[model samples]
Target chain A: MFDEHENGYFTEETSAEVVAARNAKAEDERLRDCVNILVKHIHAAIKEMEPSQEEWFKTIMFLTETGHTCDDWRQEFILLSDIMGVSMLVDAINNRKPSGASESTVLGPFHVAEAPELPMGSNICLDGKGEPMLVRGRILDTDGTPVADAKIDVWQANDEGFYDVQQKGIQPDFNLRGVFRTGPDGTYSFRAVKPKFYPIPDDGPVGKLLRSLGRHPYRPAHFHYILEADGFESLTTHIFDPDDPYINSDAVFGVKESLMAKFDLIEDRAAQQEAGFDEAFYLVEHDFVLAKG
Target chain B: MFDEHENGYFTEETSAEVVAARNAKAEDERLRDCVNILVKHIHAAIKEMEPSQEEWFKTIMFLTETGHTCDDWRQEFILLSDIMGVSMLVDAINNRKPSGASESTVLGPFHVAEAPELPMGSNICLDGKGEPMLVRGRILDTDGTPVADAKIDVWQANDEGFYDVQQKGIQPDFNLRGVFRTGPDGTYSFRAVKPKFYPIPDDGPVGKLLRSLGRHPYRPAHFHYILEADGFESLTTHIFDPDDPYINSDAVFGVKESLMAKFDLIEDRAAQQEAGFDEAFYLVEHDFVLAKG
Candidate 1:
């Protein structure tokens, strides 16, 4: 006895279409489009999976728990996005640089501004807790022209696989993290420990999902970089150590082939003397190429 | 310098495929498939929407807020599903019945297990705050055979569109909610107020989403029912008032054509006497045909 209507009722077969039609009245075109696409995909997913009522309830609870697991100090939803690779995909879609420019990746949560900006060749390894490495790099334009006076902010985890903030009193402040200014020659060098593979924050709903999916939570060892210069598009990326164990399957999918750097070991007398090292150390020399703004 | 692998890296073009390949190791086949489908759709949505980082961040925060809004008292995720029409789809898929059998609908969040059983013809409208109505129906098998001693649990919002639980002490306990059993001839009749359209609990993220999408949160006037009988599947359903304003656009998408029933106003002296009403009352005759378990 229902009256004939334009969009009709929400039958399973016409559900998504009906919703899209109903949402035609939405004022925000972008939001309406986004909502329609999301609704279409989710409906397809449910139709394909045909999850039980209990399974649906479990998903609802999982989302609720994921949200509950987040607080002022932690964000479980971002973790969920990372594990699902949406974070990287979003970065990729948003940061499609010129072919030769350094690729952007996840900035991560550990980065802090106002890092101590040191002169060329200064050591950033305040604690000296891991393999001593010299990170030297030049900031260049996409066409390979060196850019003078570029600011390169850098940070990484220490040997124990923790940021200074995570370890607090256990690690020195700004350990394995600092900023460097490129000289007129567009070259900068700094000393820090070789980065080590580390597990992301686990023991949350995202962690539980990772375990359930037969996935590991470790991100490949890498140094975080945020580069900025005049009239150029700033870049946020990581120079991943190619040899790190989790390099192939980064939990957050943050790795790119062009971003991979060789951490070469050097023990020559001259090199050791220049590095001010008494022992052989890893040397990571990676350059960044920025796109025009 | 990265090693060659089966699925390659997580590039935007192959992001979903790479994740599906990586998850091939998942032990639970069903969960793995579900995860793959969900990831595929989400990636597609992101690609289509290409939400800016700020928009994505807003989404993450919205989800976190939705979760945080949930405690022992409320579930905002379920509200999100309802507004998205996912809840009704899930119920429809899970409760597919035999041909000619009554279709099922959302049970909603207000159902209580221990609703006091009342005799047929007894009034369930404890508050008597709405238009009086006599509900008569036969519980029958699919072949039109009467099903004796069938349990019919019923509940509805009052004229003010609030469930008893929602009003607490303001409305008498068990207002317009009760259980009844079919007699030997499978005939059952009861008196209750005609349900009024109501907005779902909306002071949360789901409500914000509805307002954003230019949709209202009101469900059409309807009475909820859960019917049970021997050798047949228990049915959860609703009888929609065909003339309800929101019938075509139920926020939860809970209505179906076959579930619509006519609510005729009967002012005849004899019918009013029979309904035990001194004023005009609505009369609804709807039978439930159940499917074998």
Candidate 2:
């Protein structure tokens, strides 16, 4: 016969310190240290928040949905960080600026690794699709010395406002994208259509994330850049056009006070005539300074 | 007109400290702290590994997919942490040690909030289905004293080994689930069908995460518990039956050494007769434990 009622019985459990001592036998010291710290920090945060079980589940579910939204073309986690401004914040923290130095901005998610090499003066406008625009810039150091042979990789949305990645099959493989090396005088120039503002991808979980966070998912009109050279710290930044409506509030938080470049109107009708183009004024000169590493 | 040039740029950028200084204006201090620390560790790992762009993208893509796969029923991020053994490692670190005390385990995603209350000895087999079974246990402190009126929330799959959340409409609401209060003698009992081993939900992003990580998604047949009292540290653990195939390697790494309870055969005809049960032998057991707050 089984007796159902039994009282007074307890087990003296071991202490956490004892278990920790026992676990000191683990072979991977680095991994153990890393995991222990990570665990401690995460647990500290959890204890501080004391979130309800429902809230905890919601967080887990949010993460799960983020994973489901990922693919080769879309990275929702990055987008999540982008919208939250965490990516730009991290970039800013890592790339601090000295006084009077050009500020670094976020490296937007759309940079392609390899761009076709183009000569300084060769027009990079493969599609000739947007309003005929010329981007001329000088690369200078802090003291204004021309830094020659600086590698400049640039890409932007066409006038219709679409990056190649956004419309892969529809656009030329490298439409409006090119890599140019600065000339001896620290000068670089290129011809491409004016880029228009476009909304970040909103068809996936990121859209939901944006909605949940009460924010829009639109980036301002800007040109992406990767500037690198020997003896200089590489800069991954974006040059936002001041004219874009969202210039002051890019969804990805990529705009920076120093990264904004003046796009001047080229009013030389004679020059337009000489170039065999329409009399339409277009974007012209801007320059960047690179400090000695 | 655009010029084409190959490679030619060279320049030295600003010092790291200068860059770090200007980027210090973080919008939110709390967010900045979290992100900066995360970036430091993650980037350090990246620097150490020196993974190429493609490899980095793959990891990003993996994270993105993990987010997309999360939902109410399945949590891919938890699955990710589980496969990485991070969850169990964290639990192990946090739960520390209590030699004879029940070991903590992974808090799985299937737990639903607000289980219905049941009187001690009330059958929780709502659907009137599943193999006949009974579970009973006593509450005791480390120093051997009856802990009266302890709350116990218990849930598990049916004999067919499916939770109500898994079957949705097919399962009667709250089937095989109940919350009980220990009697004055520190004992609680319930009747239900024996839990059958079943696969974790594999249709969501958790499945994709598991597949990608080369991990199986299966939890051993066990009963979930959340026991608490005014003076004792709350216990969130599972009782794993020795007979389950997954007793050793729960997909979520939730099984603990101290939490394993043997299901003893009860074939005494007199006991069966007293309980108004069939002649077939079944399992029975109780776990006594000390409570430390």
Query: What do the candidate models score in CA lDDT, each in turn?
Result: 0.89, 0.65
Where does model 2 exceed 4 Å of error? Answer: A1-75, A80-154, A157-189, A192-293, B1-30, B89-100, B126-131, B208-214, B288-292
Residues B1-293, model 2: lDDT tens digits? 11111111111122222212222444544433443444444434433444444444555666665665565555667765564444555555556546666666766766778889988877778887656677787888887677898988888888787888888999988998898888788888887777777777777655654554334567777888888888888887788886777665465556655677777667888876664567543555767575588
Scored against the true structure, residue B80 in model 1 reaches a CA lDDT of: 88
Compose the digit string of candidate 1's lDDT tens values, residues A1-293: 33224567777898889878878778988889988998998998999989999999999999999999999889999999998889999999999998888899998999988779887778888887888998887889988888998998999999989999898899888887788888778888898888899999999988988888888888889989999999999999999988787888888889888999988999798898889888899888888899999
Q: For candidate 1 chain A, which ten residues in a row score worst on lDDT?
A: A1-10
Q: What is each candidate's DockQ, to 2 decimals?
A: 0.58, 0.12
Q: Each candidate's iRMS in angstroms?
A: 3.0, 12.8
Native-referenced DockQ of model 1: 0.58
| Candidate number of the best lDDT | 1
What would the per-residue lDDT of candidate 1 be over residues B190-257, giving only the tens digit for each residue? Answer: 99998888998888888888889888888999999999988999999999998888888888888899
Docking class of 2: incorrect
RMSD of each: 2.4, 9.8
User: Residue A137, candidate 2: how far off, in angstroms?
Assistant: 9.3
Best candidate according to DockQ:
1
Best by TM-score: 1
